[model samples]
Structures are given as C-alpha cells and as structure tokens.
Target: MTAKYLVTGASGKLGQSVLRHLTETYQVAPGDIIAGSRKPETLSEWVAKGIQTRVVDFDDAASMEKAFAEAGRVLIISTDALDRPGHRLIQHKAAIAAAEKAGVQHLLYTSMPEPANSPLLFAPDHEGTEAAIKASTIPAWTILRNNWYFENVFLSASSALASGHWYSAAAGGGIAHILRDDIGRAVAAALVAPTEGKTVYTLTGTKAYSHADIAALIGAAAGKKISVVEVPLEGLVQGMVGAGLPEPLARVFASVDTMIGVGGLAKVTADYKTLTGLEPQGFEAWVDSQAAAFNALVK
Candidate 1:
C-alpha cells in the first residue's frame, strides 16, 4: 500500500503518539501511513495494524530514499543526537536530500521553540534543520516549533520530591510547557489538513510558569513541601555533574535553565488550539495528572 503520510523516528515517544493520533483520532487509514525507524522490526505492532513500516536511518541516505519513495507527505522528527555536536545537522541535511530525491511533495518538521535564538546547546541542530527544510525542493512545508515538554521536568521533579530541594538557574523566567501528546495531536492535524506553501507554528501551552510556580504545583499535588533554589548557571552545571550526570548532558541542563532564566521558553501561543481546536492542558492541571509519578518519587 502506498503511504500518504510518512512519520520518521517511529519508535520514539513523539512518533508513537503522532501515529496514534493519525489512526485513532484523525481516522487516517492504517494502510495509508508509513512508520519509519532505524529498526523497522521494533514497529511490529504498527505493521500488524496494516501500517507500512520501513527503515529510515538519517545517516543512511539510501534508507531514507526507500522510506520516502511512496510518501506524499513526510514528517522528519528531529534526531536525538544532542550530545554529539554537528552530527544531527549532518543527519538532517541527509534526510532533506533524500526527501528531495524522492520527490516528496510536503514536508513537516518537529522543531524546538525559537531555535535560532534559544540558549539551549542543541538549538543549532533545529535551526539548521529548519533552514535545510526551507532550502529543499519540497513545494509545501510546515514547521512546528514545539515548546518544552512537561515530561522533561520529570527527572528534576522526581529528584526534588525525594530530596525536598529543587535547584535551577531559571531565576524568573517562565516556560510554557506542553505535553508531548498535545504536540503529537497538533502535528497529526497538520498532516491531515490541506496546507500550502511554507507555514510556521509555535506550539506551546496557553500559559507559562516560573520554576517556583511549577514547584508549588508539584508540592501541592504530591502533598509535600518542595523548595526551589535559584542557583548560578555554573553552580547548576556543577550540581548536575556532582549528581553523576555526564558533562555534556549536565551542560545541556544548565544551558537550558539559563535560557529559561532569560525568557527563552516563555512564549505562550494559541497555535496548538488553532490547529487542533482544543485548549492545551495547563501546568497545574498537568502536575495534578502526574500526581502518581510525583508520589511515587517520594515513596
């Protein structure tokens, strides 16, 4: 079956949610969707549902070509190679090249919010990928600049719940954290709808919250006292390193906090609602929903 939509990185969390939305919510035929991943065998459940599965390694130009051969629209989920600098950009360029060679008409990319100016160390990869997508021959493209995911805060929140202390460098900055599932729904909606030319959407929660505010919400939900301590950027990085995090990932965490402190993730947009016709979950509500996780952390 010829796939009308192709989703790269199909084994990842975001990819799985997007595929679910396409099949369950948007009602796209399973056979009309192709799930692409480096390890196609891991997508057996999707294949069993009549969805086509193909190997699409960004590093392998030939694999990308085969994966995109029969796809009308392709979604290039950004690769998870943040630790290795410059490697992700190379992979993204290769994907774009293969997509062009396959004559794919429409391309969609999952990018971070304000990559061009984000303080995050991995911002260059997204920024470069967006530029490559624009420079590609694909006639139509949509760029979803997704905000920080609430799921990302789990590690910190869990640690705080266990230790009763939350450390950060985001002094007064606010982050409009959106759920990964919400991003998936919005991406699925965009792919199913009729789009023309180049379009950009900033996908974020309706509201933004500071680290202290988030900690309060977590504290309330977990029925524990959690104090957020604002530290210096260097101190945060050192703390992370002391906690056994690798230097590269520790640096990423510290840089992200610094970015947040400078208002990098503070933008709240209605693009998610505009695309999906639904309001996004707020930070407080999301924290409440994940109460079990927080509770478990303390237990």
Candidate 2:
C-alpha cells in the first residue's frame, strides 16, 4: 500500500472546494489524493475523475483506521456535528487516533480562530481537537484557524437588509471575514506545502469591519442606507429566535457576536497571503459580488 494524501469529510462544501483546488490549482494528481467520506456514493464525480474514495466514518473507529491506511498526510475538515454536545470533539479525537494508528506523517485540521479563549459556543470542540492533535504521535501538524466567512453574514444580513437596520450585539468590535473558498484554497496549498514542525496559521481577510462598517458597505452596494442597531446579547438571541431560528441554534449563532464584542475575531493577519501568495477577497469586493442577492433581499 503506497502512501497518499487523504482528505476527510470530502463531501462537504469546504472539503469539495479544497479537493478542487488540490487537483486544479495545486495540480495534485487524482491518484495521489484520497477523498474520504461516510457516504462514498456522493463522491461519484470524484471517482470518475480517477480520484480514490474511502469510507471515513468518524463514529466507526475501525473504519477510520482502515480509511487512513497508507495515507502519508491527512487533512481533517472539522465536521458539522454540533447539534449533539461533545460529539464533534469525539469525532475529531477518533480521526487523530486513527491517523496515529495508521502511521500518518503529517496532519492538518480546519479550526476556528482563538478557540482556546473565545466565547463561541463550539470553541471547546476546536480547542479539544487541537489538543488531541498535539498529543498525537504524528511528528508535524498544521492548524488553520479560519475566521468567519463572509457567507456567514448572510444569516443576519438578509434580515438587516429588509428591516433597514443591522441589529448587532457586538459593540464597536470588528471581524476580519474571509471567503469560504479562499480559506479552502489556502488549506489546499498548506496541505501540499512542506512543513518541518507544528505550524498554525490564522486565515482572515485583509481588514476587519464592525457592524456599522458592514452596514455601510451593504448600503453602498445595494443603494440603500442601513443603520446599525446595537442590542444586548440576550436581545440579539431573542431576536433570532423570533425570526424562526431554534433557541439553541440562535444562542449559538448569537455567541459569535458576543465573541466579536470581546475582540475574538477582530485581528487581521497576513498569514493568508503567506500561504497562497494571494490576497483574500475583501468585504467590499464580496459585497459587490453579492449585489444582486442583496438587492433581492432589500426588495
């Protein structure tokens, strides 16, 4: 069994995007990369392209170990198993254990920024997963601390566009949001690049924007003026619940704003450009690109 590069959660958006960049942008051969997913059937297109597909079920440790066999490098795209508390951390640990058992040499993972001290609801999962990776026998690992995606703003942006007010719990705090695809490209580049020891990179846009700043950008792009309404954290959570989001999920989402208020996602770093030698898409550019979508929301 020859060693090859393995990417877990290959069916997901980030996973799929990373795979595309790996093959298209980085020119990694299909034969050299293995796309791992629980439902291998969904990866038919990848198979057609001559890429190897494997069943990497996090819940089934034996299956994961088998999937990791002959995998020299593995990139674990964090799963979205957030509905069940502690389940995601368990899944991540299982992947780490499987990689170690299979003698993986280099490992990589997608993580949230400042998870160790952030107030985000799912920070524990990332923090624990990072700890497990560090404790593993794998000699080298890369942790990509991805910031908030501009797409994530859509959750609240639609409502704000309609109401003419962007209600925010994060007072005067800013977030340096990068595009999801940008993060994926960076991850793909890092996976194939050489690394001597443990490395961590915080991937983010070139600048940070507060709620007011974001509202202004949206207004400029959509031809409508929008105001930023500062609300308490509890009020923000309640507002989301009123907007038909589940209470638990609403709180989890609102915690992002709370985290922002404390400067959690505010930092802008050059780590993204260092990885891919490319500038991440800026917020203004993202807004312009989504102009049609924003105008539709306004109407």
Candidate 3:
C-alpha cells in the first residue's frame, strides 16, 4: 500500500522539490500525498494529478486539524516568521497539537545545523519548534537539522553582486553548506522509509568553507573582484540600516553575525554522507553555476 505523505509549504522551493522527488524517484502514487498550506487551490495541478491538498494555516488550529483529517504522516516545514520572533513557537505548537489530536503517526521537521548554537538569530524559532516536537504526543518525529544551505548563499549573493558588496560577520568561520535541494531530497528519503520515534539528523555538506572563501568564489563567478568585508556587530547593524533593511531585521542580522563570529556555524561532520550515502556538490561547482547564470545576464 502506498503511504500517505503530507508536505507543508508545498508551494515553497523546498516543498515543491520534495513533491517532485517523491513523484519521480519514489514513484509515490499521487493520491497518497497531501500538500497542506494557506492556499491549497494554488496547487490544483498536483491535486488534479492525484495529490490531495487542504487549507492549513498555522495560526488557525481548527484549520490545521481539518487539514490533517486524512493524513497519516506529516512534514511540517518551519514557518517563515523570523521577523516577529515568538511567532514560530506559536505556529508550530498549533501544528503539533493538531497532529497529535488527529493521530498522525509520524511527523518530520526541517531544522538548522547544531540548532543549539546556530548563528542565525532565528535559531530560537527553530529551537522552540524542535522542542515542541520533542515534547509532543505524536507517536514518531524526525528533525532534519540541516546546515547552512549553499542555496542560502546564492540568495544573498545575487543581491550582493547586484549591489557590489558582500557583507558578513562570519569573517573566518566556515560552515558546511549543503544544497537546499539536497535537504528536500533527504526529507523525501526520510519520509519514504518507515521509521518510528523522534530523532534529529544534522545535515551538512561533505566540505566546509568560510565566508571569505565564498566571497572570493563569487568574485570569480561574476568575473569581477569581490572582497569579503567583515564588520563589527554594531557596524553591521548600521550597514543594514543604510541598505534600507528594517530595524528589526537589521538587528537580527547583526546578532546572527555575532553568532557566526563566535563559531556557531563552523561545525561540520560526516553526517551528510552518512544520511544520504552520496557526496554533496562542492562550493566551486556552485560558483560555476552562478557564473553561468551571471554570464547569461550579459547575453
């Protein structure tokens, strides 16, 4: 029998990749999958093709409970509420409550690397959610404690290249940056395999690199000299303000830098290889891809 899988945030990049991976590799029957979110109608094609979807807003407990009505296993992608600080715990608590009430057999979560010491100021949000999952009445749970995604670098790099500035407080600290797609694929693997109880996996790449090294790669990719500039926490906050980032975001970013400076993001291990049984893509390879994209902009 095909197992039912509910993927929260189905419209997101990670969520979409999970769905595609399951369909293409796992051959999961479309009818056995449920994509829960605020706007289920947006995923009509997936539903039409047999994947079910339902409205499940984290803020609304009743709505979330209803969404899991027919789901046996659920992957609750963390909410995007970093700016508000305490909102994540609230949202996740609702999901956990609903999942427990609905008797969902297994639950999965996407978390950050070494969440206990993550440099991201948003780590509290992730930590709180993980704690709630740990304390939940759900029969089983899995936390994919993913490291910094190579894709996360790409996000800031695109804007940095456009603005001619690469900024960070991670001066000499290195992080094992795994591809976000790999995280998605890993989640799909975990969900497909039947396992019970709550466990946390620290997902990272086979290698690690510092921000300065990353800046150098970005420079090479764009065919221009890009330098890594590390600033003090206060200076970083000021820079963010100068760049028009909101006050709350600026402070959060600055605090995250302080965490990086203290080595929160530099931890690495063989966990990625152990979990996926495959070597991850390298930083240079990611740079080459970015170079290709930048070159295309000229064409």
Candidates in order, TM-scores: namely 0.98, 0.97, 0.92
lDDT of 2 by residue, 158-209 (tens): 8888889888999889999999999989999998998747999999999999
Worst 10 residues of 1 by lDDT: 280-289
lDDT of 1 by residue, 247-294 (tens): 888998789887898888999989998999999877778888899888
User: How do the candidates rank by TM-score, highest first?
Assistant: 1, 2, 3
Question: In candidate 1, which residue ranges exceed 4 Å CA deviation?
Answer: none
When summed lDDT is taken over every stretch of 10 residues in candidate 3, the lowest stretch is 290-299
C-alpha displacement of 245 in model 1, angstroms? 1.0
Is candidate 2 or 3 superior in lDDT? Answer: 2
- In angstroms, how far off is 34's CA in candidate 3? 0.2
Weakest 10 consecutive residues, lDDT, candidate 2?
1-10
lDDT of 3 by residue, 83-163 (tens): 898888789888989999988899999887666655677887788889888888888999988777787776557656666
